[model samples]
Target: MTSSFAPDSLVLNRKLPLWYQVSQSLRASILGRSPDASLRLPTEEQLAGHFGVSVLTMRQALKELEEEGLITRHRRRGTFIDPAARRASPVRLLGSIDAIVAQQSGEHTTILGHGPEPVPGDLAAYFPQCPQVVTYRRLRRDGENGEPTNWAHNTVRPEVAERIDLADLERWPMTKVLRDAVGVDIGRITDTVEARLADPVTAELLQVPLLSPILHYTGIAYDGAGQVVDVARIHYRGDRFAFSVTVEAR
Candidate 1:
């Protein structure tokens, strides 16, 4: 029913399953609509065309929505939004690093520790020329409740680290510190998010139970010259966080 849908605005991450990504983007759009908005959805063929995907892929995405009760498809009547969708909880979708930092601006930060340390094995590839990095650890707590929400371990190139003050770590996100304070012209940031069971260290830091589910976020930042400047790994309490991405039609 919507005539203004702009498919070109939908950015799909090739790293993830195309169908799953499409479904999530659609899910966000459906849930974002007002209760008074039209409930009818475009035909599968039309949607596939809009999304630049095969009809089969679009159908798979719609099936996901149907399974979640966000939409109902009647054989010949087309798909309509489920009434329950209006009552569904709103999701917070952060599309960029700045948005993410702004979301946590009110959180209180505690500096756990910081010192020169060996490059972590997983991050070795990002810093091929360096043997060591400045490791900074911090914990973030909700400003309202003072409950711990996430823990971050950030490794910075020694040169970049030298320009950062320890006091700045408590006040700003690393990305901001790197760009604003260290004068690094960050060109790109690649992020990977996954679910993992909390280990002893992470469990204690996040105040969660051992083996409890947690969200693992890994970020690799590159400077304008294409050199890796920072690598960050953060553990967030799954209960306290939800990662969402909005797919704008226009």
Candidate 2:
């Protein structure tokens, strides 16, 4: 490892199985210690001592990681992180939210619920011809540490809504899901991020305390033909995320 291979506090959560918690802790720890994917994990005996767990428990955690395809164990060489776990740069991710989420290790989205709903008047103005929309309400959590990160609500125009599969939404990012379902290319994405305190419902869904600070984001996407493709509102846990922008000097 770079400097340390110690497990984070994530490994101490007693609510989950010990091995699972250890696995999540290790997954998050990998990116820090092996930014280049060249580091080999410490042996099981050492890791067990470091984490205050038995060798068998450590092996179970390693097995969980292996099953997730995040690590490879060799008979003589020890365990190494899969090269693909390396995260992309921040500027690269700004091109598309979906692209960034896809590249994040142990990031996953679950559809808490979905149904037909009327498009809000402001969002509806973007689609004069569509009167109603289908909505998907989802929660995004860190796959590694099992922390709730965001609560997102997405509404699609009637035409494209009919083709969407909730399953696909869970598996793919929003942009790709829209493109594949509509068979059209996305031309533009516009979004704004602001800070706000979480409301009761939002706090409950995000598992944050009421009145906790949150990053509220809203966006609208369009197709090449200039038709509104989708509208979304997302509430992210402010403490868990950080945003950086690259400024160029003239």
Judged by TM-score, which candidate is best? 1
Clashes of 2: 0
Q: Assess candidate 2 and give its lDDT.
A: 0.70
Whole-model alpha-carbon lDDT for candidate 1:
0.76
TM-score, per-candidate, Cα-based: 0.62, 0.58
Model 1, 73-126: lDDT tens digits are 999999987866743222233567686556434368888999999888988989
Model 2, residue 190: distance off in Å is 0.5
Scanning candidate 1 in windows of ten residues, the lowest lDDT window is 1-10
> Model 2, 1-250: lDDT tens per residue?
3453444454365655677657656765664342433557789998878777789999999998898787899998898778666442221225565654353222778888888877678776886876678888888777735877787788887778788888887776677777765575788777777867689989898886566557687777788888877887877765454345544575
The residue ranges of model 2 lying beyond 4 angstroms of the native Cα positions read: 1-93, 96-106, 248-250
For residue 108, give model 1's deviation from the true position in Å: 0.9
Residue 47 displacement in candidate 2 (angstroms): 38
